[model samples]
Target: MPVSFLSAEQRSRYGVFNAVPDIAQLGAFFHLDADDRRRAMAANGARNRLGWSLQLGTARFLNCFLDDPEDVPAAVVDYVAEQLGLQAADLKGYGEKEARWAHQEQIRTGYGYTAFAGEQWFALACWLYKRAWTTNERPIVLFDLATHRLVEAKILLPGVTTLERLIAALRERVAARQHALMATAPSPNQAAVLENLVKVEEGRRVSRLDRLRKSPTDVSSTGLVKALDRHVELRGLGAAGWDLSAVPPGKIAALARFAHAARAQAVDELAGDRKLATLVAFAATMAPQSADEAIEVFDLAVGDLLRTSAFKATKERMRTLKDLDTAAIVLREVWLKIRSVAEIPDGGIRAALDEMDLAAIHAAADVIGDIAREPDEDFQEELLDRYATIRRFLPKLLKHLDFDAGAAETPGQGVRRGHEVLQALDFLKAIERRRTDIDPSEVPADLLSSAWHRRVFPKRGELAGTFNKSAYTVAAVERLRESLRRHEVFVPGLRKWGDPTAGLLKGAEWERARPRICDELNLSPEPGTDVERWAATLDFVPPARRRPVRRRRRPQRLGTPGQRRDRQGPPGAHRPGPPE
Candidate 1:
């Protein structure tokens, strides 16, 4: 097929000679991702040609233009010049043949050339830039035609080198770096990896520099542009614990520009520490306070990481982090509920341990401990009251504390003791229900004598009307309910079975199927189940439907004409065919 923009009439078409105008015009094609600018720029002539046609004008190539004054951005032009070992002046405007001949010469000389360093070998690198910058895809790897073999580039491969050895080596390097970046937030362990990368990359950069130097590279735009990138990558790696302490701020800033991009080990390492804190605080403060604000920040942060090449976060990583964040938030809410009680302040102890900025209601756990130590009983009592306020959160708090793998498992005994609190609540509900349902003369005397009715819930004539005041009234009831809801594993002993349901008359099925039913419903049912609790779940069962009845019909066959004739004993006996 004829090239879209390449007139092909040869006069307008750029070939070998007088290809300068062609190069200049071609330069415009690179600037636009597509005619619509919705696509991306194409880095190379051939690649551009194919993409513009095959992928259509939307196949944008990365604008090799580095931010600078010159026509083809300094970085882009320099990248091109370095690729060919030619001066920018020589590349001012190139003909198809001139560019081709130059490219061939570059090929013969053990190198490939391009005006843009950002897209040295293939159009793909620039394409990747557009994808990430626009759509936020991962850093892609493709063949670099100018170099003749695979390069760290991302777009279309140069048609020149197919050397198996070089491809393997380049693949290994990219693979290893990519593998390292895939790991979750960097720790100190990433330090050595960073140092090792710098060591390996040094020689490669030197070789690149050597070529430009031998070709009499000036303190030109290309050199400056490359310096900028080196600075950025260096800082990014250092941030990942690669420690580019020797690098300058300019590069660090460049890397920062790309920081929101895909997870780069270097960028992540930088972000995981002080950088992360700063960004998080800043983002949180500025983001809208509505429920959607946190969601927006999450989106922005992830988007930034996507456009960058310093690291990569896989789909799985994102999913895991999402769950972690959810858990953290729920735990925080639980803390608040407990801390709200006046007599029992819950979060005081935890607040002290966290040492973080928390809501006013939350006091550090350590602070509570300190208050408990005061010689003043009144003050100590107040502190204990504050601690009691958080009684509701006690179970969740203990569970959270135990999440620390280093800590010994704390059996939720204190928390479990709270379960009867809920049973007492159930006991109350049952008393109320039975009170409304049955008469005083018919009341079961055993029900009044039950242990549960003896304390937390007092038995009033027929139904306990005067509320029982016990230490475990509301607090125990609420805590137990939450524990059951949270599915937290409690002490395995009888204490864990919760306050014995023996106090209540079991429902018909509770005597036999309670265990199996409780397991299915995630309720407590050793011998008796919480009938009231199960009431909530009964409606949750999917409604069943009966199938329609289909009856089988007996079949009847018509007799053959000969059989019919014999049976009728005449042709007149035969029936006429149906009228059309």
Candidate 2:
């Protein structure tokens, strides 16, 4: 509980004037009125009067009188003397006698100031304890607040070391209490689970906690699945459900930070209470955080799948371009030959058929038919190639994560009437439960875009009425990803992917604050008035008065064709020589 947190400079300057008082500080703290002047005048001689007045101003400004009452800035002395009509030099022989000590006692009693002892000391300690227990404020901030509190309460400020020690002690006490409260929060069975997190088991090099703390370096489908597994493992421990409501959020956050940064071995070496508290904090914090990370990983994985499919589709299109060009030429030649034959006599058709390369025309028709079977415009078919990869995590993602519409007209109806994405999720979840059979009418057609609709339901053949299950699932998951990004749908217990409007002012809160908010933003209380003002501003500018924008012209190239200029050598390297 030593005052080690404070720097030497801070401790030295405490309860003393480190610099000349500013104009405002002098006016606020050092200004003495008629009653102060009268009190100083009551002291018999000029030296006593001046000394008394300095002590009074020092107490008011510094909240504590210095050991040497005469020790103060010249500006303070001159400012006080100018008011009292006495010279600053009269303070020379002020504290030489016992009169100075007598004057301090009189000042304390007459001005309603109490010494920092007994009841005052205990009361200040209790206040510091309450502040430390409730908040995780920095020691320096608490120290400054304590100083201000002492000044306001008319209690003489204690020594810097004494105040710092009090704060350090109270903080330590609060931390111990918090640790104990969190340590006993879990049952014996749950405590064993938390303790096992730090202990290395047989056949494993690292502890469970160490393994859980590591994030996936790869962002593939496999990586996304692993992230979801980790999230499930953390949630299964039930650490988030622990009764830690009594502990302050700041305390939990501090412990979480320590646990995250410390090695498992270091945490294992801590005392029992500290170790348990650290583990509980780690579990609670990472539960929700892992959920967010899993979703983010899934998002990246889906984006990669779409990008890979699009790249493949582009490559396929490029490969078919040559075939398409050659086939078009062959067809055009045959068509012209047929047109010439049609104009000839009836017997000329036989001669034209015998002269034509019928095998070449047949081969071209076959190539055209094969290429036309799967059109290049259908990119969704490309995504279908990776449906197995999507299935690996999509089922788990749908199972573990719950989506919400964030707000609804009534409770329990949001999932039904919320965003179209939620409806699709419900449909997919039902398909997951039934696995084998799917009803085509149950498809959420509104959730499907035009591209998806064509892929999901073919126009002819066996697949015409029976929808493509994989295509539907992938479409739903992609739309879910998009809606999550747009904040149209939210995941419960997640802050990053949670409701975006949760922090906004709404309902009665917004109603109460509307007038002040409008006033601050320089708008009328009536929305119509503000809209009219904006309209007026827009109408004030005439098209004839509007200035046309001038564009900067590009400089012409001076170098010869196929001759490169070396612009990297220096500032003027690209410029030509004077004559050569």
Candidate 3:
């Protein structure tokens, strides 16, 4: 694409040798003055001062512009000058290259050197910056190409390296630091891990600085310490836990190793704790190797510990808590634990459930009802078993507490218990239907009918009306009648008409069937004067037909009569009237 095809905004987005009326028209692409013009002519016998301009333009096209004015190496400057055939001294003050550098520097603070201290440093910095920039919301490894050394000098590698090696090293360092950051979140045993990480990192830094000090040339510890600080900050719980991959290799690796060790120790300590020891022992026997494996152990152990603890606590409360309200709350919590936590084979779970007061169990009925309403298909069998178990014990529990089903004082309680009974029956019926081999007689007919009469039927009757006069009442009765006539499993536990415990009256099959209404009454009025007169009126006649009127022929005057006689004689033969 031509440079002119690029818009002003697009031109500004990229570094250019000249952005003006045209790329050729840029002031930076020409000799600045007569002195520079003479120097160009002497060096290359060129009128347009093409040498440096072409080199600079090519470099710019390659996007070598740096933010720092002084970051441009002295070698690059001299090389470009030499390539242009200009002697260093002649090009010194008047060179357009120098002028461009100066202009950029004044505008952008650091526009001089567009590269790092060396090609190796530049490559490493570029790799780190690009990785950090793309992967994170903000890059922690701050560097500007215009500036020669934004980071400490030691952070840069010692020599020019292949892109592959640098990239490999960069990834390894990042991975290690990321591993460390993963452990930065404070935990119950996090203090020990944090101390261990700091100590290990500090020791590594000391060894690195010691090595640098003994080197043949002077080396700065500034870069090493900066990297150290960045890694250590992540160890602090309050730190944002930003990616520390840009940190130097030695420090990041050391931190990662220590963090892993510390995490293992913390897990061990947690496992040994009284609350978690039981679960921890189970996990340890599994022999997990990696951090994820160990963490998984901790998660399972913690969850198990919490559940067991909750079950025990709730059981204790049910045993000791005298207040019915308080006991109900504890029972609810225990029931939730039963639903969510894995079952323990020990009889303690049952013993705990047995400890609940009658009132508490009554409250738990609500939970059971909810489960029945939205049955989990995955655990339908298990749920049915649980419902059956609860149903078996519920009556005895209520009996022991002297529950009064007829009392108005606790009407809500009775209603709640009745609802649970209905749900239990409904669940049993559903399970029995699924298994065709199971006889309908196996269902608890008395319990099902009692639940209907006591709970389900009453509410339905409220909507249907006792009089069975309203549309809702008539519709509900009609539905029942249709079901009975068809011998369908309309009523719970009444699956078949032949079932002995169906609890249906003998004649209901015939009584409930919809009655036929084939008789029609005569609506015609008896013939009378008023009726006949009404029938004779236009209002009673068909609208599409009208009664015709006959016209009377009139006699004409004497002269007209004589002519009329002649006309009448002809009319008797052939006379025509207006078209009907």
**Which model scores highest in TM-score?**
2
lDDT of 2 by residue, 321-440 (tens): 889779879999988888887986774776787888899989998888766534325567788888899889888888888889865545765443346888888887777767575667
Task: Give the true-structure RMSD of model 2.
Answer: 8.5
Encode model 3's per-residue lDDT on 1-580: one tens digit a residue: 0112334564344333232324243334322355443443443333134443433333333334333322333444444355556544443433334454533333223223333347645666576745643453212122233123322332221222232244445544554444444333334464343334323244365322122112122111222232223322332332222333443434333433333334333433432121122112212211111212222222333333334545664564465444545545667687776654436655365556566565756766554444332221222222222233233322322222111122123445433333333333344435533534433334333333332322222334354322211221212222222333343312222123222334543365534431321112322323374566666794664657666978988854565667877866755587667699
TM-score of candidate 3 relative to the true fold? 0.20
The TM-score ranking, best first, is 2, 3, 1
lDDT of each: 0.34, 0.85, 0.35
Best by lDDT: 2
The 10-residue segment of model 1 with minimum total lDDT is 399-408
Q: How far off is residue 248 in model 3, in Å?
A: 19
Error of 1 at 531 (Å): 47
Candidate 1, residue 229: lDDT? 36
lDDT of 3: 0.35
- Clash count for candidate 3 is 12
In model 1, the Cα lDDT at residue 303 comes to 31
